[model samples]
Target: WTIAQVKAVAQAYGESAAMLLDGLDSGEPVGALAAKMQEAVFYVGDAEYRCLADIGERAHDVSGLEFVALREGSRWKVYPVESAPGGDYFVVEQILIRPRDAPESSPVIAIVDDDPLLTAEMCSYFHSHGYIARPYNTEATFRAALGENVFDGFIVDWLLETGTAEAIIQSIRQSRHGDAPILLLTGKLVTGEANEDEVARVIQQYDVKPFEKPAR
Candidate 1:
């Protein structure tokens, strides 16, 4: 495919992702959106080459399709023809997206608070905001979840049974999840029991906003 043709198709598929993001933001059903997105990608360059799936699997010269295959380890891997080695490939780009545990679900949020009442309230708020909230009473449970889960955000209380909020936030930021949004919640900030200046320093260092309790 020509550079111009490739750019057009890329733009179209890029818009597809944006549309899916919009659906998520609007609280639309993720199951439906994922089902639609999983449909066969058919935007090939013009009518020049017919885009086909499963061209008899191990065929060496699979034509009428817009893909090229490579043998990796013990398996044959396939990629779009436009992105294959040295063909008409103009460029290949990786689009960063929210990692999904299930294709049909909203993003996940993690809430770390020792108080069961506060944790439940925070989880309920996030659920109403279109995100699935996972709440933990201890850092150990939250840390265990990190092994198998990726979260879109974290709501952390300043004091924890296992550690201070600053230490917890620092640990999470350094972990494999990268930089997910961390919302710092503190009753001390409202009551002037904790040093606001020092707490603000931690926020400045971590680039996460300090949020006082939201109105119910």
Candidate 2:
């Protein structure tokens, strides 16, 4: 097979592998990864082969990526291969993995905010979409909860009742739960004294996704 054929084969395999992921929406990025996996081609003999095991072998910048072997009824399929370790993969975590050997559990998100109404809204939204949301009303409570539980993601209010968002973030990064994704919610102009420069700095420093308040 020519390079195009080899790549096409890889693409087909990769997308199928990605689709095996559980709990993720698996957006339009479905085919791109398998195409990328093909990019790591290694030639062997006349028939050609793509090493499915080596798709994301050297990733360091990658986050949130996981591979799982799924068995539904009589079917069995694995992503990035069961042979690969979590340490071998890097970059952005593109897969939702729930290994067949491991017991399945719903993903959880930690929502930190001072407003009861906002926290309730956020929790309700996530719960409706299959995730379990844990809402904290203050920085102290958030930090305390972090010590006792693990979360898949975080949504923090930039302005809290008892602490500043910057301080809360800094403390979070210093904790064991820092590796989780952190998203910020603040008005476009923000409250307190945080100017655009300060807000931008916080976003960059912590690698957070910021959601400015919607216009009324």
Candidate 3:
């Protein structure tokens, strides 16, 4: 198969693997989800191939076939059947899909702001642009999520309803996401609600990018 065909097959396999994992993560039974797998058709270059899903049964069939390794997301490895030795090489018997150790390709951005509207808007914008943006209306919720999920970056409002975001920012800087990008949003600077010197010191110490709101 040509390079384009190879890419097309890889894309299809990745998507399928992601959907399967999603199903399993959502409490779906493994056997029930596996049974729903259908033959994936790939139009590579000027040719077409119907690739069957092998859920442990057809392992021997793909033993001799040339396998094309495709990495899907950070957790899964997909080996799609590329070419067979005998007749009807285009129509492969099975495609092997498995898990792999890797970081997530999709960036998970944390949007921490007290304003629910702004948080929602930021999350929506990031989602529209192909990112996994999670919104938090309070520091508590954000901290709770921080313990459960690994975020790629942070967009935090400096002034929350009850307190400042300095503690939250400090926690992030000292944590595993120390090198992650952090955008500090604050309308307090313009409104004279916070000390400019303290804000600047925090920004410098934490190595955070400060943005005065309303952000465009």
Candidate 4:
């Protein structure tokens, strides 16, 4: 083939390929086109060309097509080309999107409360808010979970039957999950202590909720 004629055909094919690719810029669709092009450009010869030089000494001349293929899924897929009637159809490309797990879907919430009823209620509340709530009846269980799993936040009772609420708070404060937010729930400490100053102090010191009343 005349070098000039070969170059023109390659350029025309490249420009048309590029323009078609521009409309399909997502990486998935581009990859599909790349796979198809690789299938199309398979060769059986001893041609030495600059573009296909690296593929193998006897590979098909794919310098132009390779350039177009490389930029298939990118924003630069917008090159102009002219069409001739009855011309061959460029290879068809497709993208197949499938469902995958989200990285942030399983955020954990640890609830440190001694009452089984309270623990169940807290878990229900957190789950309602789209978090994975793991409730424990003792400081030991909470500590074990803290050691084994990562928690994004916590909901702790202000008073545990085994010890002061401070003990659980301090235990959680010292664990690897120390950075997690803690929402402390307390009975009406003196019948009416859920005031703004107390809530602010609790939120500032731990992270949200000086006290959420136990569910009725």
Candidate 5:
């Protein structure tokens, strides 16, 4: 393909085919650019002929810029074929890539509290705000959940039916998701204060509140 052709199509797609070529010129890995071309290009050949065709097509841009490879002595060689019609290809000279919106990713929120009613309340709140909510009633269940999924944020009770919230928060901080936001809810002022000092130190944020059973 011609340099002008590559630049034209890239411009039509709002991408910088020329800039990509420039990046490749700088000796950078073309993997990312190649991947993007896989999405934009309408057709892609099978594995055997894919790379050669793409490179061959791109090697020729303007009429005179011939693809060259040295064999022996002082002579250079050029392939007989011209620009391949398909597979991932880019035009690298100098162009601009227009900014585009990124794909949407939903945030997840995890709730760790012994009270079923409280779990429901907190889950409902997060869900209403467009977050995917997961609830756990015990330390074991919360730990198990972490082994399977990652959360954007977490809400742990000040006191569990079987263990202290501090211990659970500490364990969470040590997990792969240790840096995730954790909001601790508690009815006792002292526990809240203590958590706010040490355990809550690692928490992104926390809330203290009195618990009331939900009405049927």
Candidate 6:
């Protein structure tokens, strides 16, 4: 990861902690606050477990709180101390540092598109060509997978059901796989769903190669 990427992650952690603190001060339940943070994707890896514990004599669980970051097998356990106005709350943030599956000999590609048929066909095509292709029908699932797995390349449709693929592209560029090849797939240019200038800007901004739909 680049220095900027590292700093960005750190900033996110700080922001998450602040958010948690604010929520607690505002009388929000710890579990609810944690759930919100989890949904916000502050931690990078797969969240193994997240819970609230008392810092007082009620629990006194200090097993891994001393260290800033702990490596457990393929995951990293992080403890971000939060001093809520109510008291101190032990916040355990577990992020998976590596993919659960063993590294593949062939390139692993992620295809993100809302169209089930297109996603399936692309996955099948890549699989036949010796690439391990994973298909996601929505941006949410693709983002979820990003935290759990590493991909050698990405093929994302320019437009998704929820929104444009700009956020997804930006995420890939900012992630550990910053140099990974990204191919933007879209039929919108021909269909008038997206303008040429918009498409060109995204392609140049992320340095991604653009492939028109029905790529042959």
What are the per-model C-alpha RMSD values against the true structure? 17.9, 17.5, 17.8, 18.3, 19.0, 19.9
- Tens digits of per-residue lDDT, candidate 3, 1-216, equal 475665676687775434443543557565765576543433344564433343333333455654432323322122436532232222233452433223377799999988888889898777644578889998889888887889999999887876888899999988888899999888887678988998999989999998888887
- How do the predictions measure up, each by TM-score? 0.49, 0.49, 0.53, 0.44, 0.42, 0.52
Select the stronger candidate by TM-score from 2 and 6.
Answer: 6
Candidate 1: TM-score? 0.49
Candidate 1 per-residue lDDT over residues 46-97, each given as its tens digit = 4221122222344344354455444444333346665444422211121112
By summed lDDT, the worst window of 10 consecutive residues in model 2 runs over: 39-48
Candidate 1: what lDDT? 0.63
Give Cα distance to truth, residue 166, candidate 4, Å.
Answer: 1.2
Q: Give the TM-score of candidate 5.
A: 0.42
Name every residue pair that clashes in candidate 4. none
Measure candidate 5: CA RMSD: 19.0
Instruction: Give the Å shift of residue 57 in candidate 4.
Output: 71
- Report every candidate's CA lDDT: 0.63, 0.62, 0.68, 0.54, 0.54, 0.67
lDDT (Cα, tens digit) per residue for candidate 2, span 102-215: 212778899888888888888976764457898899787887898888777888877676645898888778788788788888873645454677778999999888888751
Over 1-216, each residue of candidate 4 has an lDDT whose tens digit, in order, gives: 475665676687775434543675565654454444322121114331111111112213333332221222321121112221122223213222222235366688888888898788768866644468888998777777777888888887766767556656766778887777777777756665435454456567765556547443
- Which regions of candidate 6 deviate over 4 angstroms? 1-103
Name the best candidate (by TM-score): 3
What's the C-alpha lDDT at position 59 in model 4?
16
Question: Worst lDDT window (10 residues) for model 1?
Answer: 88-97
Candidate 4: where are CA atoms >4 Å away? 1-104, 191-208
Reference-based TM-score, model 3 = 0.53
Model 2 score (lDDT): 0.62
